[model samples]
Target: MSVTRRSLLAAGAVAFSGALGPLFASGRARASAHGYGPLLPDPGGLLDLPAGFSYRVLSRAGDPLRSGEGTVPSHCDGMAAFGAGGGRVRLVRNHENRADAALRVPAVDGLTYDPGALGGCTVLELDPGGGLAAERVGLAGTAVNCAGGRTPWNTWLSCEETEDRAGASGYARDHGYVFEVDPADPHRLGAVPLTAMGRFAHEAVAVDPYRGVVYETEDAFVRPFGLFYRFLPARPLGGPGSLRAGGVLEALRVPGVPDLSVVDRPGAEFPVEWVRVPDPSAAGTPIRFQDFGPGGITHAQKLEGCYWGGTGVYFVSSYARGSEGAAADHHGQVWSYDPRRGRLRLEVRFGPAADVRLPGDSPDNICLAPDGGLMVCEDGGGEQYVFGVTPAGEVYPVARNAQDIGGPGAPAWGEFAGVTFSPDARTMYVNAYTPGTTFAVTGPWR
Candidate 1:
C-alpha cells in the first residue's frame, strides 16, 4: 500500500503513541514526526522549520568565495562535516556541474587533474555558530562530482557522478571516480582519484569504518539501470587519502534471485552476494572486467544516498514504477544492507502512484539523527522537504524548504541536498540545491 500527504494523518496516530520499532509498522507510516511538530510558514519565504527551530543561511551561490577569483561554484550537492577544533566545523561540498559549467573556480596553477572537466569540491570552515570562517577549492577538474561519504579518519571521499570519458565528452582524462580531500590540510591542494572504485555513474557512498569496507550507490541518470557496489580495500585503510592505495570493487548479487529489483514491499529481504569487478576503473587500458553482464549482476533503478548505521548500511532507491525497464513498481524505497546477516531488507517504501499520494517522494540523500531517526532530503516534484523517519516507521517533517528560488511557477520543485549534523549534535546543517545555498539549523533535541 502506497501513501501520500493525506496519509500523514494516519502517521500522527503512530507518532503520538511513540510505538515505532516494529519493522512491520513501516507500511502503515503516513504522517510525520515534523521535528518540533508541524511546519510554521517561513515569514522570510526561504525555509520552514518546526515551532521551536530556526535556520541561518550561511553560504549561497555567487557569493564571493573565501579564496579564488570568482563566486562559489553552484549545483552544490553532497557534503560532510569535520570538527575543526575550537568548536568550528568544516564542510566539504561537491559541485555537480559538468564540463560546460566552466570557469566558475580558477584552477590552481599545477594541481588540477583534468582542466576539461569542471566538477570539483569546495571546503568551508565554520565557526561554532555556523558562520563561515574560511573557504577554498579542495579538488578541481572532475566531472559531475556529486554526493560522497566521510572516512573515519576525518577526510571526505568526493565522488564523480559521471561516466563521461576523456576526448568523448571534452574531458582531458577519463571521468567517473572517487577523490579524497583533507579539509584541514593547510599546505597544498591536490586530489588523488581512487581508481579502484568502479567507474559507473557514481553517486554517494558509505564506509563501514570498522571493516574498511566501502559501499557505493550509482545514480543511473544515464543508460542502463544502476547497481550497488562495495570496494574491499586491499589493505584496511590506514588513514586519510588511503583509498588511492588500491582495492577490489564488487557489485551486489542475489544467490538465485536473478534480479536486484526484489526490494519492493516494506521489510522485504533478500540474500546478498558480491561478484568481482575486475576492471573497476572501466578504463580502456588493459581492460579486464569486460563482461560486466556475465556475472548475472542484479540491477536496481537509481540507487542513491547511503549511510552506514548501527544495524546496517541504510540506502535509498529513488521512485521507480518499473519505468526504464525496472522489474517493480515503487515510488520510493529504503533498504538496510546487513553484512553480518548477508542480506538486504526493504526497510521502507512509498506508494505506487495512482493509489497513494506519496508523501516525501523521490528521497535522495540521507543522514542519521541524534534520536536514532533518519533525516531524508527529498528531490521530487512537489514542495521540497526534509522528512524524518524513525526506526519504528513513524515519519515526520524535519524541515520544509519553501524557498521559491527557481523563479515563477517553477513547479515548487527543489532538491534538498545535504542533510548532516555537527559533531556536537547541537546544530543541523543542510543545503538547498541550485542557486545553491547552505544553511545551519538549531533547536532543542530530545
Candidate 2:
C-alpha cells in the first residue's frame, strides 16, 4: 500500500529484492545520502531507532488478547494498517504458527474452520500517537498463516504457508489455504478458508485493485522451487475481491527466454507472460510444475514477499542456491512486474556469494513509504533491523530490536517482520517474531 503522510518528512524511506550482481545503485553511495540518521541505541535495550525516532510495543506474546480466551501468540508475521478516522487506525496481523506449536489458537465454536490448525490472525487498534487502543483475535484455527495482502475492500487476506494434506499431523482437514478477516469486527471473524486461491507454500500476496487480481508468491524450497502466481477473479466486473468467489490461476513465463532465471542482476529485463493453470488447487505439486514441467514454465527459487504499487507490482526472491534447487545462488533479489508493458525488470540484486544466504541481512516483509520509498524487515541472523530503502535506491537502518529474550541462539535474534505503516504515515508498525512484539514507531520520519 502507498503510505500517505501528514508531512513530507514521513515520505523519505523504502527497500528491495532479487538475485545478485551489480546493484542498481552503489550500496555505498546510497549510504552517503542519509536515512533517519544512524539508529541511536535504544536505552530501553529493546528497540533502537534514529535519534528523534522512538517506538513502543503495542502488544506482546502471552499478553491477554481481547475477545479471546488466552494471551496473544508469537511468530507475528505479515500485517496491514487501516485508518479508523479521528486519528485512529487498526492493524491486522498474521501469526505464523505451524500445526505443531505448543501455544494454542482459541477456537470460537462455528467461527473455527479446523480445530487442529494453530496459526491464525490478530487485530489491534492504534491511537494517533501509536498507543494501543484495543486488541483481539482476528482469525483462528488455521495453520502457517504467513504473509498476506491488504484489500481495497477494507479486508485483510491471511495466507497459509503450507499445502499440507488433510488428516495429516492431527489435522482433521487439509491445511493449505487463505482466510479473509475484517479489521473492524473482532466478534464475527470468518473462520472460512479461501481455497480457490490455490494451495502451496504461500509466502505473501499483493492485490491489483483495478483488475481485482491477486498475485501470490511461493517459497516451497523443494526441487521444483516455487512459481510466481496470479489469480484472476471470477467476477471482476462485480468488483468483489473474494477468493472464495473462485478464479482462474496462472503462472508467469518469460516466453522465448526458456532458461527463466534472469533475476540475478540489476536492470535485467525479460518479456513476461502468464500461462493458464488448469487447476487452482493442489498441494505437493503446484500447478506450475504439473502442467508445465521444469523448463516448460519460467520460475524462480524462494519467491517470497510481494507488494502492489502505483507503478508496478514489486516482488522478492529471498535467497536462492542449487542446494535449494535454485538455478543460481544469491542472497536475494527484487523485481517489478508491469502488466501494462507485459515486462519484468530486476530492481535490486544483493549478492552472489557461493552460498545464497542472508545470515543477518535478508529482507522479508516490505511496505511502501510516504516518500515513495520501501520499508523492509530483515528475517536473518544476529540482531535484526528494519531497513528503509529510499526511492533513489539507498538503504538505511530504520529500527532495531535488542530484546535479550532470544538469548544467544544461532541466529541470535528475533526476526523483524509484519512491517506496515499507518495510512496517515504518522506511525510505523512492525513485529518481532520470537518474543513476539508489535512496535509502533513515531517521530521525524524523513
Candidate 3:
C-alpha cells in the first residue's frame, strides 16, 4: 500500500534522542529519528537488535527440509509472506543459486521447470508464534532467483537474475524469466515462465493493484546499464494465470534524460513515457541495446527493489558511482513514479560518504512499513543492516547481521536481502545473503 504523507509525518513525529547512536550520527541519516533504540549486542552472534527485540532463526542453509528429499538451498534472496488461513503464515522464498551451489532447491516432480537448473523458491509454513512448521520446495529449475514482489491475489512472483540460455550453461532451456508461485498450492502453477514479461536480468517486480500493471527493475551492471519496465497484461486484475496470456513489455523513457543517475537531487521530477520494447525475448540482442530512435529509453545502474505505494510505485537505485561507468555519483536513491500522471520524482538521495558500512548505502529489497515508513536492506560492505526510513527521510538501523559463524577473527557477515513484514505487522522477516539464513524478528514495533 502507498503511504500517505500525513501518515509519514506522523510516524516521523515520534522521535527519540540519539536515534542511531554514535555509529550513524555523521551521515545524511543523522537527522532526528525514532527507531527501536540502539541495537543491543547479540549474545548468540547471529543478529543484533534493540533491547526489547529478538529474532528467531526460521531457516538455515544446509539444513534438512521437512520433505526429506534434499537439504535447504543456499543464497536465499527475495521472499513474500501470505496468510495461510487459521492465523498461519506461509512464506515463499527464493534461492539464488546456480548449478554450482552447494545446496540446491530439490527439483520435485510437478514443480521442476528444468532438472538441470538449481535455482528456485521454497515454501515455509510458520505458526502463529513464528515457529517453522514445514518446509518444502515450491518452484525449481530456474537459475539465479533474485527478488520478486507479491501480487494482489496472494501469490508470489519469483524473478531470475540471469540471462543464461539453453545449452550454454547446461542441458536446459533459456532462463531469465519471472515465475509465479502460489504459496497455497506449491504445484498448482508449476514452473512456467511468464515469457511475455520479457527476458533480461530481472531483479524485482511490483504490481499496481488498482491498474493491474506490473513494474519491473533490471540489474544489468554493464555499460548499457539497466532499464525500468512495466508489463500491461491483457486481463487486468484477473489474478493468477492472467499474466500467462501475454502483454506488451515497455521501458520507461524520459525526454532528454537518457540516464536516471544524472538527476542527483531529491525532489527532481521528470515527465516520462513508456516505449514498447521491439523484442520482449531479446533473442539475439539485449533489451537495453535495442533501438528506440533519437528519444532513447532511460536507464540506471543497480536498479533493484520496488513496491506499489498508496499513490505511486517506489523503486530503488542502490547506487551510481562515476568510476563505475554511471552518469553521476550518489550513495543511494529512492524514486517514486506516478503512473497516473506519467511522471517520476526522486524521493530520497544519499550524499557521497567515505564510510561504506553506513545504514543508507546500497539500500536493497525495500518494503513499506505499517507505520508509514520504509524498511530497506543494506547490500554494502562490512557489517550489513536493515535500515528504516521514515516518511520524512530520517534513516535508522532496524536489524544487523552478526552472523559470526566463521569464528571471532573471521566474521562472516552477509548483505541483507528480502526485508518484509508479516501480514499482521507484528513480525519482520529478513534474509542473510550468504550462509543463507532467514530471520523472524518480533518486538515492540513503533
lDDT of 1 at 87: 95
Best by lDDT: 3
Q: How many angstroms is residue 137 displaced in model 3 relative to the true structure, after the best TM-score fit?
A: 0.5
- Write candidate 1's Cα lDDT for 72-112 as tens digits: 88888899888989999998888888766733544654447
For residue 327, give model 2's deviation from the true position in Å: 1.7
The RMSD (Cα, Å) of candidate 3 is 6.5
lDDT of candidate model 3 versus the reference: 0.82
Alpha-carbon lDDT, every model: 0.74, 0.73, 0.82
RMSD of candidates 1 onward, in order:
4.2, 6.2, 6.5
**TM-scores for all predictions:** 0.89, 0.88, 0.91
Best by the TM-score measure? 3
Candidate 3 structure quality by residue, lDDT tens digits, 1-446: 01232123223233211121211122233234566567667989888887789899999999999878699999999998888888899999999998688888998999988899999999999987789999999999999999999999999999999888899668379998999999989778999999999999999999998999999999977779999999999987798888999999999999988888888666678999899999999899989999987788898999999888776798889889888899888767788898888889877776463222224457789897656677888887657777776655556677878875456786556888998889988999989988899999998775
* Candidate 1 vs candidate 2, TM-score winner: 1
Stretches > 4 Å off in candidate 3? 1-32, 353-358, 405-412
Better of 1 and 3 by lDDT: 3
- In candidate 1, stretches whose alpha carbon ends up further than 4 angstroms from where it belongs are 1-34, 186-189, 221-223, 284-295, 353-360, 406-411
> Residue-wise lDDT of candidate 2 within 189-257, one digit each (tens)?
478777778877788888887887789988766667778888888865343234678888888888765
